[model samples]
Target chain A: MITLETIRTAHDRIRAHIHRTPILTNQTINELSGVHIFFKPENFQKIGAFKARGGLNAILQLSEQERYHGRTMGPVTTHSSGNHAQAVAFAARQVGIKAYIVMPRTAPQVKKDAVKGYGAEIIECEPTLEAREAGVREVIERTGAVLVHPFDDDRVIAGQATAAKELIEDADYDSFFDAILAPVGGGGLLSGTALSTHYLSPRTKVFAGEPEGAADAVLSFKSGKVEKAPYINSLADGLLTSLSERTLGYIREHVTDILTVSDAEISAAMRLVWERMKIVIEPSSAVPLAALFKNKAQFTGQKVGIILTGGNTDLGKLPF
Target chain B: MITLETIRTAHDRIRAHIHRTPILTNQTINELSGVHIFFKPENFQKIGAFKARGGLNAILQLSEQERYHGRTMGPVTTHSSGNHAQAVAFAARQVGIKAYIVMPRTAPQVKKDAVKGYGAEIIECEPTLEAREAGVREVIERTGAVLVHPFDDDRVIAGQATAAKELIEDADYDSFFDAILAPVGGGGLLSGTALSTHYLSPRTKVFAGEPEGAADAVLSFKSGKVEKAPYINSLADGLLTSLSERTLGYIREHVTDILTVSDAEISAAMRLVWERMKIVIEPSSAVPLAALFKNKAQFTGQKVGIILTGGNTDLGKLPF
Candidate 1:
């Protein structure tokens, strides 16, 4: 279980380095959905996603020797095709280190260029889990670099929790929310949010929203175990991670429900937010909103808070 | 000419009512353009545009007679097909008045829906300047509504000046910017920015960026006079106004240049911002960026500020 003290320490460490992203109130979405909607807009954060929180925390938590000796000359390895790769690269650059990102060859050029722009090296591989692991290992061995897992790590989970901590402190408004929805992937963010909300605002129910194409978290929550997703086909690249053991355990204890949204619903909700609220959010960010809209019976007239986890979609090639 | 004191008073009048939108830095654009780019992200402003500033200021400056005598119960009229229509509608709602928006029948459904969502009455007109004026007059006669000119009024210009005022106040980092670039329509925001910047930071140059297709301001600047737009042809709907006499006079005295960009450049800049910065901005917001990028030699290594005027694009049918 994560402690408030650890999360609070992480918050302090990354405070100056990361953006205290705004929690925007959407009157339009509220009127449209009939639920009081508060969006924790992480898109405004540095590196354009909430992944900055975790990466910054992990990098700052390293020992002096690790910071000086490991990062100075060699590279840091990460396997991601989304915001995490950019976050790690950004964090590494801030810490005076190079990053070696292992991405599939078919990854968006936008993401690839972003990683390169941060002075990071890239090693593109086949679009398979096995190839990704192999590419990461090769970079780790060749460069003698540190491996920063996107999620499935304690520090990363603690870092992701800080977003929730800020929300509870700044946006919870002293009113006990009926529910708080967070999208779950490898479960780092959701688990961290669950732990923080359970400890700080136990009266508010914590729910994990997932895409139907990436419903490992839902299955894991139902069976009281960790579930492995052999492959993910959702447009939401962020929520494709299977449940990590630590994250799953925390979710089992703290989260109230695990709901799923279809790809079509996510796309529709993404369009609704862009058309109505005028905010550019990726499909993954719309999962929680989609869940709220699809399961309106559960959240009717409820003070529901949602983490719009990311907005990193390339507008030129939006799925919509 | 507008004064700093008037702008400050406008700020105070709507201090709690409006959002002090965040300033976003674009690394991708900075790298590409070789100039440090700072975006005054009014895209995040209430009503999803900086028009909120002018609308709120205009309403707040209304005389007591306007507020009482049940005149406030009647609708407020504005001739606009863009952010101003929504801004006036939102401001009217805040002041407990109905808004009668006169928009072209060819206005985007998204903008129409925005006005409708604010509880405003929409009066559609033929897509012509003469037809629009006639439609607005008809609505005004029918409802006895107050006319909130989008950008031509003194109150609107004073209100729009606050964006530059806030930017100058928010960061006084000891380095004077070479110039401040903003799009010009009726020149409310551009002229107001020039006034405030001239008074506050005399050394900083203020430039009006307009689309080549709607270069009335450019022609006005060249001729040292106000000029009417030949016809509405730019994709940037918010930058399609004829230069007002007051605005043209102010720009003639204070603004250093009036630059123009092609429609393709505007669209490209819009796409770049949406992809790299992960912020949704309308075509009008990208005009200055387009101007800066298209004419890079003019701003090389110079600290530049661009007002990202709004984020009202419909994601379902983005022009790209």
Candidate 2:
């Protein structure tokens, strides 16, 4: 039910809380790919990801009844071991609210520390989606907190759309872009991008870049139904999640196509971005670039926009 | 004499050719150091350094008589194993001129390849400053090319000043910076930065950041004369060169002080920039930040500008 107006409202509401990340262009990359590319570096955003927009928008939109119970502000709860956990925690603290983040025990220490650093109370759970969800439910039941599902919520999707909205509006690309590409995870960024592009620049096609190892979005697009990968083995750890039905609905209606890229291609693209652009981008962010380069024939001689999802990576564990 | 007018002219001449590199800020670094830090990321510039501005300015400012010898365009020659070689080559190629770069045979293959990639012919020399100068002299004598000294030349220094000019003009700081710090090698960036700050933001004090292992700049500043390190041992390879007399003259006139940081501190600062700023900066660029952090007491509660000199690094040979 998220519309252009909803996304616009979210953008306006969260505008002050987030960074209007820079859109950078590289001549070498443009010449190599045979396409003019505008890269929206969300890694520079607050909390180091596009998720900040969604989390902030979602938190700021809470009604008085939802935010407060008596004199105390009610807690917000989420189950994520990824950027969303830190995003929600950061946004919650910004609004003077407590956050209960349910994370798996197997999650990286850096992510856990980041979430904790934001003044969020962590509820450790077993390394499974069901266990994580149950942990979140338990925290909510005990604390009377509202649950903000990462990608399933309409408000979150509307928040994510602001990244694309800003990209389309701010980039001084001559006229409109021929296409826009975003990596597909739980489909939050991809679906949000699809909606924004559909409303803002109807002529521009929205493409979803998914990892070949976790090709649920691609499979779902082909089968015309929600699908899950049997075994995910991509180096893009942020893209291992299956798409929610809500995200799939938006993708089916608005996204032009779902493209897949291998882990090797993702690593190569990541290295190129680091070496050429002098910007740090995670493997997930490189997926879109990998797909764009792999399908250069389809996008030759056209202006393209690529959303670099995030830049949270272990420098010690670089893929290269 | 290099004046503010000279720097301004360089800015105007090279404005169209080089990137107006972005000035970025980080809340984490500000909080950590107790100083408001404005980072002028010249690392993102063409040739991945501020040298591009100087190289482009020097080449473009060449007189028709100097640029051409009858029907044939005169070649430009320089001896550099660092970012300057690529900068001169890139600038030369942009103006339809040939570049002769002299480098030690022991220079990184990647550095040599980058110069060659820009259509510049590389003249391999022995790994000594004497050999480098002799090789450059040979190239100039053979081809009747003009020698563009990296930092000592007034035109190149003026070009380097443009980075600080843009930084002073573009940064959204509420007021002029209290102080500015730039890493010193042959003193091109530091002296240029001092001149720019002296002219533009007269209230701002300029400091030179140098590696402890290559503390010639500090020694020279104290002695009021040019000084050279007995043996350079810092990880910041770019700051190993001794300051030229032309550059030292400016440093003594305008620079507030010369501060030195250790290689360990440089590595730590570089890691922090990568992790927090989400930008790739070479070890040389980290010297300023390390110096700033070490002497936080001096700059406490003050607004400081740190020029990140370059981002050209061998990815496989990361210090971290």
Candidate 3:
């Protein structure tokens, strides 16, 4: 498990680079659910997602010798659906390194354009996890480039923890929140947030929100062991990752519960956010809110802090 | 003319009640136009439009006696397409007053539902200014309700100026900016921004961006007289207004340039913003960018500020 001290250090390092994203207070939501809901809107970050925090922090933490001597080679390589690819590409550009992104051919054009705009090279692959993984491995082997796994690295986890650190520091809602809910995919973000909350604000319980179709984390939490889904089939593409070993350990210790919601629920939550908050957020970011609404009985009369993890949704293709 | 001091006072009165919306740095636009472009994203404001600033400030300024007395006489009335109507409805509901909104029958159902969600009574009229004005007057007189003009009012103009105030306060780009560009409708917002730039940073020039199809503001500015269009037939519904007397006076003195963009250019700008920034914005908010892009020569190598006044666009029905 990642230590709280490491998470704290990561928070301090990334504080200047990442946006202390705002928490939106919804009166209408409170009135309807009888739950005090505060949305940690990470959608407003520099790269339009929280992935920037982890990607940038990890890249920045490389030793001076490692960086200058090309110990990590000339490029950064990653396999991502969208947001993570953009984050890696953006961070690589910032640090004067080339980025080679392996994306499924079916990925949205907008995401592709964004990655390209950040001066990254794109390698298109078949729309399959195996294909993406194989493609990324080939690139890493051929170019001798550093592989920035989207959410599985310890440094990445620590960097993602900074979001929770800022949220806790900016808002005096320590005693107000009964639990903190975050979307769980490969689990770097969830692990980092859980780690930060366990030490910084131990009173608040941590809950992992997973889509029903991609509920590997839920099964893992239930079985008291790590689990993996061979392939994910859900609208929340960002949450398709099977649990990593480090994230599994973090969840076993810090996460109190794992909740699941259907794709329909995720879509509905996305619409609610757009219509009510006027902020554009991707379907993956809406999973936590879906979990909150699905399990309202558990959260009623309690303050629930939900991390809206990303906003990479293409407005043109809204399910509505 | 409403002095900049009065606008600053309005800003203070409503600062806590409204959101300090973010300024979007347009990197893609800057590269495309050879201009440093910064967009004031007022679409993220409370009530999902810039109108909230004015509505909240106007309501906050009312005396305690007015709060109680106003409620007894029934709802406040306003004639608007959606944005201002929703703003007034939200403000009225927040202050415990009933609201009656007169909207065109052709108004989007989503907007009507938003107003209704705020507990406002909606009165529909033919999709014409004459019909809307007549219908709203009847409702106002019958209910003894106060009328909140969408624009063309001192309070609204003062409230609108806060966007410019915030832009200057948050970004110290005075050295880079040659001009601030804003869309003009009834001229309330443009006039307010002009006054703000004129007094706060006299070195920066102010430009009004108007729709080519609805070029009343541009004609008025060029003629050095208040001009009214026989009818508004532009896609930018928010900029379809005849300039008010006070607004005209301020624009005549403080505004340096008035430029127009075709509706096609506005549509392209909206698409670019959605595709690039991943933020949904309405047609009026895209006008300033359209003007800058259409007349690239005017803005090349110059720092420009464009107020993206609202983001109330329905992603489902994008013009593209």
Candidate 4:
């Protein structure tokens, strides 16, 4: 469970290691959504995503006994085909540790190259959830490396909370934003965001945007239990994972609601941000804005904050 | 004709109306090019380009007699199919005036839409330069709108000079950059940049990048007169214009050298900025960076500044 002190402590631990990414605003974006929107762009973060925060926090906290084998790090490991892979790899190199990233053979080349570029040893596995976990387990058994779960960890959740903490601190003068939104994938960002909002600014409500193709979080929110999505097909490729019990518990308590948007809506919003804001954001980063525009009545004339998650997108495969 | 005082006065005249856009740096870019690079990102400026500075400066300086035919502004006219058209249109809107933009019929739709979105009346003509000039002259004859030449006039050059002025002021403290680069089209930005560097950071050498496909500026730089390119073709659509007599005069006096790059090199460098820096930049903006990388030995171990011109790219037609 994350308390206010937990996030503050995590921020202090990782503040020097990661970027306190800037909050950007645009008049055209505000007029279109009918809200005074403040965008917390994590796309410009280390490794080009907010994952850098949680990854560094998790790694930096390793015990002297647990982290070191003489001079070199005992090695940390993670199985991811996403920004988290690059995050772990980059964080390890920053603190003089070795990282072993287990990615599926079918995973994107851009992500793979980025992880390797950060000097992480990549172990390619079969493109299946079981294969990925097995690969991580194999690496742990052989190399005596610690497994750093991508989302379902107390340390990572606490670390992710710092993004919202920074956002609230920067955007507030007298009162906080009227509402705040973040995309829900494995629910790590949403849960962390919710906890930070509930602790730092009680009046502000927390909401999440999930892709219609990956509707597990929305179902879990309604059913009061972790649930699998009915289907999986979306341009927002980063939000395709199921939520954990740890993440769902926090979401059910602090989050107001979960909204889903179609791929058409997501791509449209993404293009607008690129064309109007002149910032490169991936499809997943557009989900919250898409939800806001789809249901604009709820936030008309109010100050709303949306976390733009990352910018690690493959430009070769853009959906106009 | 454009002195340091002229640029300073222009900056004062249009500071409130324009965004003093940010200067961004990326570690990967610096390492690859082996030079400490400071990027003046005018891509995030109003109208999504640096053209906004000159356009606003020109429009804001319109006289009480020349600018007023009754109540509404007498209207401003320009013949451009690129970012300049949108700049004039956006600047006109800011000052509560009408803008008549004469654009070639073959101009990209994305640019035409942006100009129209800013309340400019678009007058389309044949794709030839003569036809475009006739269209602008016709607009002047009918509505009496003052002609704001894209880059030929001294006022426009002085306005464009502010981008480099701000770049030098922000990036230098004890010593100036070793060299600075800007893409040369009609030479407005390059000539203005040379003048500002000459006045403020006299130690900094002024260089320019031009596409070999549209390689008129290099010839003009050597010939001491405006000369046309052998052929007109490039992915950097914004840098296809030939230099004017006024721009050529300034270039001969202050500019150090002009470098030409192939379209392939420009597109590759453009992708690198988009991928590594996570910022949206058009093909023309990447020319200077491309030239820097192509001739890296000259800039090794030195601090260099490059002005990233704009970000008005069409997502549907991105190369690559």
Q: Candidate 4 on A4-44: residue-level lDDT in tens?
A: 99899889989987878888999999988889999999999
Which candidate number has the best TM-score? 4
The local distance difference test score of model 1 is 0.84
lDDT of 1 by residue, A175-225 (tens): 456788899999888988887787677788998779999888888888878
Q: Which parts of model 4 have CA positions greater than 4 angstroms off?
A: A63-73, B63-73, B172-174
Q: What are the per-residue Cα lDDT tens digits for candidate 2 across A276-307? A: 99998889999999999999999999989999
Candidate 2 residue A30 C-alpha distance from true site, Å: 0.3
True contacts kept of each: 0.68, 0.76, 0.35, 0.88
Judged by TM-score relative to the true structure, which candidate is superior, 2 or 4? 4
The pairs that clash in candidate 1 are none
TM-score of B chain for each model? 0.93, 0.96, 0.93, 0.96
Predictions in order: lDDT: 0.84, 0.91, 0.83, 0.91
Q: Rank the candidates by DockQ, best first.
A: 4, 2, 1, 3
Report how far off residue A22 is in candidate 1 (Å): 2.4
Docking class of 3: acceptable
Q: Of models 1 and 4, which has the larger lDDT?
A: 4
**lDDT tens digits, residue span A1-320, model 3:** 46778887776777776777877777767787788888888877878889998998777766344867877536779999778899998888877888899999998887898999899999999999899999999998999778888777998998888887777766675655688889999899999888888878889899988998888998887776778764578989788878877788888889998888899999998888876676678899999998989889998898788899887775556777
lDDT of 2 by residue, B191-216 (tens): 89999998888889999889999989
TM-score of 1: 0.90
lDDT of 3 by residue, B39-158 (tens): 888877877778898887666665344656873434678999868998889888877888889999999888999899889999999998899999988997899787888777888888
Two-way TM-score contest, 3 vs 4, winner:
4
DockQ values per model:
0.55, 0.83, 0.43, 0.87
lDDT of 2 at A269: 96
